[model samples]
Target: MTKTGTRNRINAGAWLISPPAFFAVALLAVPLAAVVLISFWTQTGIRDFDTALTTANYREALSDPLYLQLMMRSVWVSAAVTLVTVVLAFPIAYYVSFHVSPRRKPLWIFLITIPFWTSYLIRVFLWKVILGYSGVLNTGLQWLGIIDDPLTVILYNVNAVVITLAHAYAPFAILPIFVALEKIDRPLLEAARDLGEGVVQTFRRVTLPLAMPGVIAASLIVFIPTVGDYITPRLVGGPGGLMIANMIQTQFLRLNNAPMGAALAVQAMGIVAVLALVFVLVLRKLTRRLAQ
Candidate 1:
């Protein structure tokens, strides 16, 4: 209430907030600003500096068929991963939330999260070993007389990319859906049963509607990162499996075309952001209608 006390309180509040604010600017904003700035200028070499601002990079990236195709492929692959993860996770989440005893739920959840405790790169490489020409799958299939020859289709392709990304992000999809399902009141289902609703009808009317937000959240979490992912595609994707991020990498690292690479990065982020916004908006509208 006193002037000195009020001043001290204000200072303390600022101090409390300042660290995070400083961290955000230092870690996020500054790097992002640098990328944007670099995107506008053409690069000649690793050490060469040219500060001339141009739209040539953006124009070339937008107009190039190869880049455009890669971008489309990226979108398609990420969308597929999101869809598959959500569909698979929903049933698991449903079973865990409704059917399992509370005492054992944490154990099941921990098992679900166990894969995440392992190194991601190691897990991915393990898939490579399993899916390779002389890998366990091929060897087993051959021994079982299921296949006469090694299958090259499993290692480096869009299918491999989808499989890897889906596995990697599956936990992300599950947790949100599980949380949403757990938050639902049990009495709602009981009330539905009391009103003579069938099991499928109750789920359709009560459970699915309430779980839309989690579905949206999970889809965004999986899709957005998958779209921007370079590692999975690099490790699993063959020449034909190259996505937009791969192209961006080549532009920056191999081609030494920083401006073009930056343009591609910016474009990828922008497109994903717009799609995410649209998804969130649609989900919000649907949630409102469901509430009504």
Candidate 2:
């Protein structure tokens, strides 16, 4: 090509890529950079920003039992939600992907996604009513003489948080698994069957291994959001339901300690990132072995 033509092509390629690059830098990278910078600084309760840099926020967060406890609780709760959602979603996804007719697959997938069209807060509030002492479940149970008094144990606890999150994120878990399961060739299952493998053995050896990527993807999606979630715990978790996100909110808004809040936010993000990395690495290794 001529020099001018080559130059024109180069400019066109740069123009095509520049907008997204600029948007990412402006929207994502810059904000993340600011948060990292602020995380290293110090802030008094009265001011929003402090120019002084210190390790006090990180130290305080690490040393404080309440913060540490909340962090651990967040991890555990998120893990539980991810596990439940994955376990429940996998079978539904598998059925829709492999067992159902192609004509019916879209319908089943559509039904799976119907819950997401509603407001998340409203859905959670509905659960609150169902689980509440004077709510439908309690009323029904009392009428049937299933129990004498109302059951307060159903709401305002870690279990409530887990249940709500699991329901909310189930679709997220299902879709990825469906995609992975759908990608598997039918002949592979036939090959296993032809090799004298039983239904359970074929599934264990062929299907589950093929679906690991989706499992990892779904788990990360549910787990990451659950860790950073403030709403589910705030509304459902009365006292023991508080997570690290709650503390981060308090520091940022109530105490006006932006720097400290940023620090805590970074700490939480770092922990999640590390865990996600480990999960992805282990999943990739397993996938490689399965492929072999």
Candidate 3:
């Protein structure tokens, strides 16, 4: 094609993308930029703010040990949720992709996503009831002669958060992994077997390596949102389950410290970006080493 024709094509492509790009910038970029600016401002009292630019909010948010602790807790809770979801999801994805009949694969995938049909708030509340003292689990266990008494420790804890988050995010984990597993070349498995490799060896050498991209994708999808989640932590997490998001919520909603809250949010975003980068880099290194 002539340079003029090529230039027109490029312009046409840019024109096609401009609408959504502008829309995204107007909605997303504007709000994020506002938050970044607010994080630098100073708050005098409840719902009162000064236009004076200062780093007081960031300074306090960083130096204050309480917010730091909450941020760390958020990281750990998100990590645990990601780990559990991916681990539990892998088996179901593997089964559906490799064992279930191709004709029925869609049915199984639909079944896995049934939980998403309900409201997320409803899911958290359902877990609250199920795990509450004298809840279904304890009552059923007691009826079955499994335990002597109702376990008070069943709800309002980190374990409960992990279980609920894992369940809520399971479908996200499963879909990516199932897609990856589906794309694996069957002949590779046959080749490994022909070389006399054991089941575990074949998986380690071929299956897992090939499926890792999906696993990493699933982890990032689950982990990033899970870290900023305030609802699950609030409903089922109780005081002990409060994450950085909860603290951020408190600063803005309860304490009327929007600047501080914005600072916390900014810090959380930075931490998430750094953590995601690290995960991708480490995964890439490990996969490279495995290939060697």
Candidate 4:
């Protein structure tokens, strides 16, 4: 196209994108700016707070050993959820993508998303019922004579949080991997086979490499929000399962420390950002090495 035509098209594109851009800025950027600003203010009492700027919130959060441990545990739990969810999701996505008929793919995808129709809170509570001491799992095990008594290890801990989060986020992981798998050139695998590469070898060198983007995306989807998840940790996590989000909630609600809560939120965001950045860099390097 001519320069004038191209410029006009560019202008039109910008106009089309402007609405979502403005919405994002108004909703996300503005609220985030407010949060950062509030994090520096001083909380004077339960109902009263001052606009006086201070770094004491950050100092206090970083200095506290309990907060530090909770942050670390949150990161660890998120990582575990990402890992387990992706691993479970990959096979299902692969099956649906490669084995299912194209005409039926939509049905399979619809089934995968059926869980989303329910309230997330309800789903977490459902997990509590399923994993509770006298819940479905324990009852079933006892009926089968697999256990002499109801297992106390099933709920109210980090393990329960991880299991519930993994199940909750499984759909998020599957869709991305399915999309990535769908984009793979079938001829690449045929070429590998013709060159005498075994099934496992072809998958390792061809399929897995090409699909890394989706896997990374799936991991990020599970990890980022799971790190901030307070409800699951609150409902089923109990004492040892408590994460950074729970601590942040305690500050805002129970402790009545809004400034400190805001500070904790900011620190959590920073930690998540740093973790995402490191994952991207490491994945990029790995992709390059594999390419070479």
Error of 2 at 46 (Å): 3.3
**Measured by TM-score, how close is model 2 to the native structure?**
0.92
RMSD of 4: 1.5
Q: Write the per-residue lDDT of candidate 3 for residues 178-215, one digit (tens) a residue.
A: 99999999999999999998999888878888999999
Off by over 4 Å in 4: 1-4, 290-292
Candidate 2 structure quality by residue, lDDT tens digits, 4-54: 999999999999999999999999999999998898887754754566777
Ranking by lDDT: 4, 3, 2, 1
Once fitted onto the true fold, the runs of candidate 1 whose alpha carbons sit more than 4 angstroms away are: 1-14, 285-292
List model 4 lDDT by residue over 1-292, tens digit each: 9999999999999999999999999999999999899899998887888998999999998999999999999999999999999999999999998899999999999999999999999999999999999999999999999999888776999999999999999999999999999999999999999999898888887888888899899989999999999999999999999999998899898999888999999999999999999998898788667645
What does the lDDT read for residue 38 in candidate 1?
83
Q: What's the ranking of the predictions by TM-score, best on top? A: 3, 4, 2, 1
TM-score list, all predictions: 0.92, 0.92, 0.97, 0.95
Off by over 4 Å in 3: 45-47
Model 1, range 81-177, lDDT digits (tens) per residue? 9999999999999999998999999999999999989998988888888888998999999999999999978879998888888899999999999
Candidate 2, pairs of clashing residues: none
Window of ten residues with lowest summed lDDT in model 3? 283-292
Q: Indicate whether candidate 2 or candidate 3 has the larger lDDT.
A: 3
User: Which of 3 and 4 is the better model by lDDT?
Assistant: 4
